[model samples]
Target: MDEEQITAAAYNDRSSYAKNRNKKRKSAGNRFLQNAKGFGRKHSFGRGAELEQEEYNYFLEILEALNGMTGDDTEERSTMANNVYAQIRDKEIKACSNQLSSRVLDNLLGFTDEETLQHVMTVFGENFRVVCCDKFASHVLQKTLFIAVLRCIGEMQVDEDKDASECRKKRKSDVGREMDYNLVMDFSPGHRRVCGKFVKKVAKFLLNNLEEFVWDSFGNYVIRQCVSNLAGITELKIGKGNSAEIRKLIVPDKWFKLINEFCSRLLVWPQFPEFPYNEFTSVLLQNILTSLDQTQDKFQMLQIGEKLLNDSFLLKDPEQDQSDERQKLPKVFHRDSSIRLLEVLVSVADPNFFKDQLYKRLFQGNVLLLSQTRATNFSVQKFLDCVSDKHILEHFFSELEVGLEEILQLGHTGVVASLAKACSRLACQQGKFVKLLLEALHCSDATGVKLLTPVLNLMPPEKQSSVQIHLHGSLILQAILDFNKPIKLVTAILETKNDQLAKVFTDPKGSFIVNAFIASKFVGEKSREKLIRHMEGCYMDLALSSHGSRVLELLYESAGSSQKEAIVRELSERVAQLNSKPWGVIINRKLRVEAYRQNPSQWKNSSKAIGGQRAEKIFDDIVDTGSQSKKRK
Candidate 1:
């Protein structure tokens, strides 16, 4: 018990202690050599690699633990156990004197085992305080930590066993519960807290020491990932004003630029699987659209506008082809995203920006995709109203005109007509749009004409006149006239009292009214009379031709006893004024031929009916010549 006796006892025990320590070191060395052989089969090694080989062995053991794989390989397993303990004891000393490099961290994160992850975290937490204090450590090490934490957060499970049972139940029994769990898992409070703390640390570190690295090198990717996670986190209702925190962290221009870059990259791949990169890009773009400040950076707004346009085009069902192997996919209107981006662009973008090719593409593309029945019509109307420039408005109208033309060409008459209706709604003072509507009506195919009927009816009476004239002159109108089905054409025309139609019929160059009258003759006396009255005020030339004779025939067929008197009186009045010498001679000859055919004996005695001496001589010559030859026979 005396100090000298205790010192002698300690010295006597020192050899045993040395023996045990040496045996443990030899066992660890042998196990490490075995692991080195395993590693050499998979990976090439460099000089003096044995000392460093212990680190790689430690990393593999940690990965196995994280993966929840524990086994009976006592020698190799004991070596890992001893190394972890040694790392904890010498926490202040650099384990490899190289810090945990990004490459090492990357390899660790790629592990699928949970135990390995936990071990890595354990080792990292032990040395992080010391390693993170160094400036170089803050660079690669902090970023690696941030990424590892994020991956862990993404993979974290609240109750894996319970969730597995629930997932089975959800597939067979309670779908709603499974859906709720799936939604909650991504944004659970515990996950958010863990992710937020890690993100905040990385953000602060970057702000404090690696500001230049962030600004110049990793700035865009880091900001993008953070904002995206923030958006998903906010949706979970985790923390107060997380969006505000994100906004504060990033410059507005840089944020939107990053969003554009992410969105552009997204289109490169056809499908967006549930990967972090995919989710991050989608969620970040959404957040940027939602939080964008139009007043701060107009160019950002324009860029967003361009991005939305590109997205809309890319998401569209590929152009229709009968030979396509893919089944028809639903059209992605993406209305909410598009409208949000458009509103910002309109408010902040220069008036000329609306005229840009991108803007034109979106407005013409998705704006035209709107069904005629929905609120999109109203949205487009409001859009047109908010825009102030005449040239831009004209450009919009011009694009619509082009779209309408395509719709008609494709035989989408209903869509073409609906578009014309939309055009008429564009600021009533927009005369150019009104003109375009009229032209559309004129040139529309049959379906277009049918679709345009409602639009024509909706037009103000004052505007209807010019539109009607345009319709009358259109080739489509001629086709309708020649269609021979008088009812469809009559129904279309009579629906609107177009004053321009009257002018067209009387123009001498347009045949709309004249053709209608001719068609009515075949339709019936009632229809014929109605058309005749419509034309009587404008088409005197049409009334005097065989067209009038046809009208007379219809009158004779359908006239009532009382109607007959009126018809005869009208015909007499018309004939009495027809004083052309050639017309008079032709009428006289027609009357004589009728009399001779009705009564041949009477005609032989009546020279006046047959046209005087010349007519008698011709008849006598033919009869005398024929009788002399036939009587001799």
Candidate 2:
């Protein structure tokens, strides 16, 4: 029974072997169909194009899934949509070729929801290296990183709004206990769980493998995206290294390591033989310098700042013409980065931190060079904004005297503008800087006027003007008028032949200067009174001008009651003929004057000038004018 019965039984099971093989084949086919479901419906013979058409519309399904994730509170459909998302994410992994990855990523990023974003964040963290290093997956990774950043920033803002709302509610409750309210005082718990985690994960992963990422074709882009994200976070108060929130999320040593690693890259960039330097490193450096605030970090930061400065071009002796010095200074490859680093360093420098050698090198050793280098001059303004020491200004003046002509010869309008702005800002805090600047201007013979030449060129040309002056001069003059004892300068300008001062009121560029002069609290009240009287006489001329009209409108805001009445009366006489935009605005101001006069008590509370007081009156006046014009027609 054992041998014969066993042999016979085995022979009888032959059909079962074929059946089992067929069943396995069937199961494999089903798995294939499940993966290709995103690929659209299959086609029979002569329907290949139709199959492709279905596959082409696969993006629509992706979008539909994303819509469910991001869309409204329809609980019934959302459940189905979420199921679609899970299937797409989990089943599509191996089948998500580059093309499909792009489509999925683009749609997901474009229609980000809390759930979909959280899914991406989870996937990104788990397979970060593979995705980021992959040429195809890296694009998705970059876009997802940026979207993650936007999500984090949005959550931070929502938290801020919630806090603000809570504060307001508490204030309201304290004042009125009878009011009952139910408030949503917090963000979704899901958001709280994933919001900060993604950013920290991204930072650590990217920073740890920065070298590998920086060189890979697709990975470089991930590095760029990471740097950009860090740059933005550096500007945020919550993301700063020393912030309490940042302390909770990342240790000081880790934060310092991240920045120090980045800084070291900048210092070593020039040494790389084959790799071309990019501006992204510069951007990252600037942001890092701006973000680091702890006192312990200052010494290392100071060393980095000094390295950037030493690497930069500088003028050694102001007495010797800058031509030789300019020639001696090697052409820097990273001038922009060096200049920006210096700017950030100076802007954020602690007074105590920069009190010694770095201070001297900045203010005295390189002062002449900074003022003359076109790129450095912009940063020079930032330095001057922060520097309070009187000696620095004194040193600047002394150096400026010897190099005034050469500095002017550089012929950059931005340099001149920045110099004027810095000097003006300095003059506000101390009277001595203004005196020094003026004396330098006077002492240079024609170079002082040359310095003001850019200012003079800012004025718009006019047909009736006899003499033209530059508005660049006016920015300087305006600064002087605002903060200086500007009597001498104002008198000298007014005394110019061919009515030069009067021409400023109508010149497009110069008109702003005139307005600045009129509104200045520092321009001796008597000087302002004289200037206003002069403007009042030319009120009609100014109101009719394109740029001058705006200035005249400013005059209406700043002018005294008598000066205002004079302007309104002048505008009233010409309102009928005024059809141009400039003249219409003047007429609008005239309407405000009349409205305020008609209802002083009603207009009294309005802070804004033109439309603030009696908006209805202005409307009525417009209607009345239209009706009158119609009657005449």
Q: TM-scores across all candidates? A: 0.26, 0.60
Model 1 Cα lDDT, one tens digit per residue, 363-385: 55445544232434444544554
Clashes of 1: 10
Q: Give a tens-digit lDDT track for model 2, residues 1-633.
A: 453353344445544665676556345434433454535444221111122344435544554453333123234333543454565576333323345435454433424346775786787788887777665566667666655554444433444544553454443111111010111223366664475567668777877786676666666666655654544431112222444222111122433555566556656655322122235455545555655543246765776666655554332333344466543332332256555655667776767645554466555665667678776667656665666665665665566556654664565334445455666666633355444444434432333223333236532222214345544455666766666565555664444432344466667667777666776676776766665666555666666666667777776766666676666666656543332343554444454544444555444445234344567788889999999999999
Q: Compare the candidates by TM-score and give the number of the best one.
A: 2
lDDT of 2 at 243: 42
**How good is model 1 by TM-score?**
0.26
Number of clashes found in candidate 2: 7
- Regions of model 2 farther than 4 Å from truth: 1-111, 126-143, 146-187, 215-280, 293-300, 306-324, 330-334, 352-359, 362-366, 373-382, 428-455, 458-474, 492-511, 540-547, 577-579, 582-633
Report lDDT (CA) for all predictions.
Answer: 0.41, 0.52
